[model samples]
Target: MPKEDQNNLLFTLQHDFKTKLFLSYIDIKFKAVLINSSTSWYKLASYTIEEKNSVLSKIHLHLDDFVTIYEEDHEKSYAIIKGIF
Candidate 1:
């Protein structure tokens, strides 16, 4: 996606969730952590395979998609890619 589009997506992600995720697992385990507005980190581990696939498709979040990284808690973090719609 274009840089402008990517920025818009990132902005939406931040606005919706306030804080970004830290140390999310995009591997086979499909585990992820999300930080809330209060700065508390929580795990997102209950997503079923079918639900995950559906959300992934809706957001167009591909493995190869260029993501903006944030360095938090001394680890590389990323915004949970979600669609505005």
Candidate 2:
């Protein structure tokens, strides 16, 4: 599929997130992060996948995405490559 199609597919993964994800911040362009209800934040793992680079790989987050945050992780979490929605 085209890059745009793949992005739309990944955006839909938001519903796949079991936890409550909120728009913590919005960077330039379509870049953004959805933070769970907890204070913890998960940076997007990466942008390009080594191969095939499926929607799952492009975002570095599977259907059920998760991460471990430090006590004061806060906005410092720079989950890059979890590209535009």
Candidate 3:
């Protein structure tokens, strides 16, 4: 959809995820967003928010758990927010 809609959807996921679990970090880039795993270090899911927002939105909305988000972009436009989760 539109960029604004995508942004709103992302915010919704972020809010819901934070309410359910303990998020480690969330980063938003250009191509995708990366969510840090709560248990393992190597466990992470890189999601393309713009493309998969619809599907992911539904999942995240219902499952309010800690899920780190990292946006995909050149030079890594995303960063981890420490002590926020």
Candidate 4:
């Protein structure tokens, strides 16, 4: 590749990465699953908006409630909800 081509490729890569990083941090939606002790369990009948602590405020939790939160399009659940803040 020529010098101009290399510079263009670098710029494109950098721009793509920056856009992805910014989108990942902004307006992210999350899903919080409630863990039950028995074999039967289900998702909550509510929406969780991660912006401005809305998800944390709307959901009521108990000491025994084993809640696991997963980011949109992610398979792994976060260990703790407070870590999101």
Please report the candidate that would top lDDT against the real structure: 4
lDDT scores for all predictions?
0.48, 0.47, 0.47, 0.51
lDDT, candidate 1, 1-85, per-residue tens: 9999998996786665542234333333556644454433333222334464465322334433455676656777556533322
* Better-scoring candidate (lDDT), 2 or 4: 4
**Candidate 2 stretches greater than 4 Å from native:** 18-85
The digit string of per-residue lDDT tens for model 2 on 14-62 reads: 5454232332233233365645543423544457655554444454553
Using lDDT as the measure, name the better of candidate 1 and candidate 3.
Answer: 1
| Candidate 4 structure, TM-score to reference | 0.32
Candidate 1 minimal-lDDT segment of 10 residues: 39-48
Model 1 score (lDDT): 0.48
Off by over 4 Å in 3: 22-85
What is candidate 3's local distance difference test score? 0.47
Clashes of each: 0, 2, 15, 0
Q: Higher TM-score: candidate 1 or 2?
A: 1
Question: lDDT score, residue 40, model 1?
Answer: 30
Question: Could you arrange the candidates by TM-score from highest to lowest?
Answer: 4, 3, 1, 2
| Candidate with the larger TM-score of 1 and 4 | 4
Model 3 clashing-pair count? 15
What's every prediction's RMSD, in angstroms? 16.3, 14.4, 17.2, 17.9
Candidate 4 C-alpha RMSD relative to the actual structure: 17.9
